[model samples]
Target: MDTREKILKAAAEMLAEDMGAKLSVRAVAARAGVSTGSLRFHFPTQRALQDSLLARIYEHLLPGDPIRDPALPPRERLLNCLRQVLALIGTNEDARTAWGATYRTFIEPEPTEQLRAAYLRHEREAERRVEHWLTVLAEEGALPPGDHTRNLRFLLTILNGLSVERALPTSQSVFLAEAETLNAAVDFVLSAGPASPVESTQP
Candidate 1:
């Protein structure tokens, strides 16, 4: 492999499995089996290397990565999709955590434009899915009719806050309980319509 590619790979590996040691240029070069000078020649600065790595990892964690299950009904599919997104916030070893550390990099006052745009796009896509499905069900009288756009934004805000907060020093129970509250909030919105008997088909 080329020297540039080798250095990038080594930096990524160091960042893997929740290790934060990947930011060191010397360490990264050693891991890549290249001289520190070689790594610096390519990256020039640590910020350049760190920013590039963060972009790659964010793509991996995008909401679109998880395709909806065809076996489930539309509502269930949407709920399951949201569940998967919320799952990103947890500290459980089983849950995805790379996004956590990468997010920390962007918390600085002046994150790069690329990073900011990527985050906004993900946030919008997430809100769109939740708002669209809820709006459809509400119009069909299957779900309680209410202001879905505002509600969807509120729910997503919960997710954003939790993901950022739990990424810091926190506990797993907080995530689980937060997920429960979110699930209940969704259910409550579903039940907001007039009390009328309707046959629901399981997806």
Candidate 2:
């Protein structure tokens, strides 16, 4: 394989082995059997490397992402994407285990710097994925023109709530409730009017 590809492969393996360790330029270079200078030439900064790595992970996490399917309605496309995120949390025992791990790592006790950084990295990745979905819809004129920051936050908040509910006991049909909630959230964002454009000062 090519030098750049080799470096990326090595980095992906390292990430799979440990989510938050062995990502430094020196470490990746050593793993890839390439010089640090070569790795630097391919990825100028750590952020650049991490961004590329995360993009690769996203692809692996969702191959042939449903968000890119043009045949699906915009709302449906977005709902499908959101559902994929929740699916990772699984259901019943799997969901409980995921929540337990989260509490131990982030909630019960104060998180250390390493733990905090790892959490932030994951949070940013999630934000990036949502932003990309909005951008795709906006490009197709399927989404209204607006500052999507609020919309992004709204969707994520809904998702977080839904994920929490997965581990809880509820009388209602969780699947039906989740579908209705996701549909309502998607409709609310999609039906909103465009943001007001800033007036230009030039005469």
Candidate 3:
């Protein structure tokens, strides 16, 4: 693979496999089978390498691609989008660890600017995706009369919080039970919006 691809792969592996590992230039160089000079040539600093890795992770999580179920109605599409986004909140152990570390770095008062900025960007992208999906449903007249963006932020925050709780032992059961919230959220969204054909066609 090319140098850029090698760096990205090395970075991703390092991030996934060694979240606690201090990502030094030499460390990444060794991982990629490249020289420290070569790695530095591509990424001038450790923070730069991490920012690149975070960007790659963000792309993997949400590429901004259109919804996969093209034939579904706008309400279904919106709900599907919400489900997919919520599913990113570390459902499994590895994911839980990765996101936990990420959130730590984000909340730290002394993390490098690169890490903080990258996380802020990721959060913005997340909000935009949620807001965009909400807007789509609103335009289609599928949402109820509340402030969609604020309501979306409220719900997405709950999903993120639940993901964190699931990472801990005492709250795992609570998080599992909260699947009902996701179901209730869909019902609320649909009921608040314009009637679905499913609704209108019912005898």
Candidate 4:
């Protein structure tokens, strides 16, 4: 990767690991195998680096809207929607690792204004993503008519809890894989709503 990309990637990895507290120009430069001068050339300040990292995280987390194919069975479409939500946790070890880093970067407390701004930006992006899917489902007659904003908040709340649960030792102790957890969450949402009954086909 180019130097700027390398710096961003290194920063992202650090943030994923909850090393945001320790991030510094020098450390990022070392991690990227670039000179501090080079790092500064691309990102002259920590806020600049942080802004770039936040954008990258959003890009990774908020993948463009899922395909809402009308031809697919309702259950299939709902499962696809749920999987899209669960995808935020990632689908594999590498992805989960990257997600861990992102989670750390997102929730870890920081006093900097830039960090707070980044956090809010990420929050809005997350809400937009959830709102987009729910709206699509509603338009497709998959979701029952109701207050979408409230529904979005409710789902996001549960999703946030599930995300945190995945990071806990208790979840691993119970062998609760990410997919199973997500599937269960999705099932609950689909079954509780006016959405079609879930098919036996695995998500």
Best prediction by TM-score = 2
The TM-scores, one per candidate, come to: 0.45, 0.80, 0.55, 0.50
Candidate 1: tens digits of C-alpha lDDT, residues 119-168: 56445556766676666666656666755665676667766666655555
Instruction: Provide the lDDT at 152 for model 3.
Output: 66
lDDT of 2 by residue, 96-124 (tens): 88787778656776777877887788788
Best first by TM-score, ranked? 2, 3, 4, 1
Best by lDDT: 2
lDDT of 3 by residue, 1-203 (tens): 99977987987887677444557788878989999899888899876787677667768886764444568876567556666665675456755775667756666546776666656655665676666666666766666544666556666776676666666666335644666766677677566653323345556
lDDT of each: 0.63, 0.84, 0.67, 0.67
Per-residue accuracy of model 4 over 53-86 as CA lDDT, tens digit each: 7667766875653546757765566556666655
The weakest ten consecutive residues by lDDT in model 4 span 166-175
Candidate 1 error regions (>4 Å): 1-79, 88-99, 102-105, 109-115, 144-147, 191-203
Error of 1 at 198 (Å): 31
Enumerate residue pairs that collide in model 1. 73-203, 144-193
Worst 10 residues of 3 by lDDT: 193-202
Task: Name the regions of candidate 3 deviating beyond 4 angstroms.
Answer: 1-68, 109-115, 144-147, 171-176, 189-203
lDDT of 1: 0.63
Clashing pairs in 2: none
Clash pairs detected, candidate 3:
142-193
Better of 1 and 3 by lDDT: 3
